[model samples]
Target: MTRDAGRPVATPSQTVGPFFHFGLTANAALGTLAKDGVRGERIGLRIRVLDRDGPVPDAMVEIYHADAEGQYGQAHFDGFGRLPTDGDGTCVFETIRPGAVSTRADGAQAPHVNVCLFARGLLRHVYTRIYFSGDAALDEDPLIALVPPARRSTLLASQPSGEPAVWEFTIRLQGEGETVFFAL
Candidate 1:
């Protein structure tokens, strides 16, 4: 049987635009459950999400990580979170240091947080990894090893001068320090 002709051959992907804040930002205001009851060493991260010209004033951030003991996923303690950036394109996440998880390859993965970025003009969210400079096992991370040495620093968060357990990292969408995004 022949089908009707009036239809889109493929649905176009929706791009983030001028009004994404109304929905995603509302969730960010209430997304910090880890700030209160989780275990392990707590950490506060500050990040600036940037595009080619400059900072993305209204970017959104999402993260997933394992618990202090490397266990993750549960209704009671889901390790997922979302945060919206301020006008300065800065976002913060308060959570505990993620524990290392064993890989099928050979060794355990280094302690790190997985991040997803959403901002205006992006047709799809971008993915990246964040590693703590304070981790003693940082050098052994398999993922980090995959990146070139020169660009690897972009993935590691460093502690600020006077803030204990606080780390800083900037996400550059393009140009010189563009962050390395994973395919899947």
Candidate 2:
């Protein structure tokens, strides 16, 4: 590539990854949050990443959120976790359910975990949120209200049958049933 006159030529864009496992995974608390004495209901968050074809095993999943009391950065609560997907395209985080976050004086945001997805073929990572399926606050969340009712389910993480403590969320990068990624 060469400069044209005084202006530099635009280069073609490239995908962000094939992430280097060592750099992203080194010395990281990969998927365990809620260490002992973190006051909240302990639960497992199971995340699956998929493309139009099938499961995506090479993706990295990260989540950060408020603690059980809607407070973040507490000494005992790390409030963050990151993990690479396994061959099954799944990663599980053992953490406590976050409490409802008060985002406004007149309303409260629903309890949710903020998620980021990093995978091959993406120009940059994408952001999303995972809301518990049955949370009553979901009906009133300002953010949730912004999403169309038909597409809102993509943001929900549902508990599997007989797995009361484990919630499963699937992220679809494209095609039908694609998960919604927020611009922010």
Candidate 3:
């Protein structure tokens, strides 16, 4: 007896890690409301925690910002929301563009969203602010310059989608692209 030569063959290989395919979960709270139905935008943030070896599933992400009109308050603004990344380690936030805030110093900060990251095994949560890449105001922003040149890139949010109004970014926990931490 002989086996058929046309039979499919099987090969063994290493399994792909979750980090490579991050953001594959559904967050109910972040879903959009409609008269007929509910739709949700996938929360896909490239989050990297500093000094951590791999993805932190328990990390809680929160973002606060104002609407397109630059209005933030109880009547117009909804408070912050908490979200956790899927096994792939990505969190999504349904937020609007924040208004430009004036710094204590001479210049003003560009319209930007604020991000807060909290995870297990960390003594304290990390605080970092994300800024738009092409905002003209960034050139003279004092806070943006406070970060060292080497680490400045990390603070920038990615515009992968190519929609200037909407933004995206990945936080590198280790290696290159690590976000800059603020003293406060």
Candidate 4:
């Protein structure tokens, strides 16, 4: 609220409570379209959404990864996927591994998926990347190298027990160990 002259004035504000999913979600999370019609080393991923207060249910996560050759816009793969969290604040994706991508300014980026997160209490969407944990090139990836060392681990996705090519990761939207968010 703001004071105008002698009386209190209304201030504009917005919150990501209940109504955001309607516009941004087009039943994208209802199925596994991201994995359809592609052939390569298939990988499964599970992401848990958390915040300072703990589990954040109904959050939406969108991801994009390059094809096997680190190229995009392929005839067989669209390179984009979207998923909404379950009541337990869990989201899953089944997509092929992305090859390394090169950037003129940053050199090369390790195999990873770009992600966007949307949920209640956020003013706007949060953007981040999910890098494969075992990548030897992770330390020098242009984007990963730019991030502070301590926080870089938050962006990595680790493989779970005995799950052949499956990976797991967690996203902390705020508070301690919050995941990094790019300005863009």
Best by lDDT: 2
Candidate 1 ranges with C-alpha deviation above 4 Å: 1-14, 28-30
Off by over 4 Å in 3: 1-27, 30-52, 69-71, 104-106, 161-166
Indicate the TM-score of model 2: 0.90
Alpha carbon deviation, residue 4, candidate 4 (Å): 20
Tens-place lDDT per residue, model 4, 1-184, is 9998989999988797655456655664443534556777888888899988888877888888788788877878778878777777887787788888888785778998888988888888899999999799797787888899999989999998899788888999888988998989
The regions of model 2 sitting more than 4 angstroms off are 1-13, 26-28
Clashing pairs in 1: none
Clashes of 2: 0
Residue-wise C-alpha lDDT for candidate 2, range 27-143, written one tens digit per residue? 446688988777999999999999988988889898999999888778888699999887888999999999998875778899999999899898789999999998999998999
Where does the lowest 10-residue lDDT sum fall in candidate 2? 20-29
TM-score of each model, paired residue for residue: 0.85, 0.90, 0.66, 0.84
Supply candidate 1's per-residue lDDT for 97. Answer: 78
Per-residue lDDT of model 3, residues 1-184, tens digit only: 3345977666554332333224425555742211122122223334434334666655666666544444444454553555666555666555544556665575567766667766654456667787877778777777887777777777887666665444566665566566776767
Count of backbone clashes for each model? 0, 0, 5, 0
Global lDDT of each candidate: 0.80, 0.90, 0.58, 0.82
**CA shift of 154, model 1, Å:** 0.9
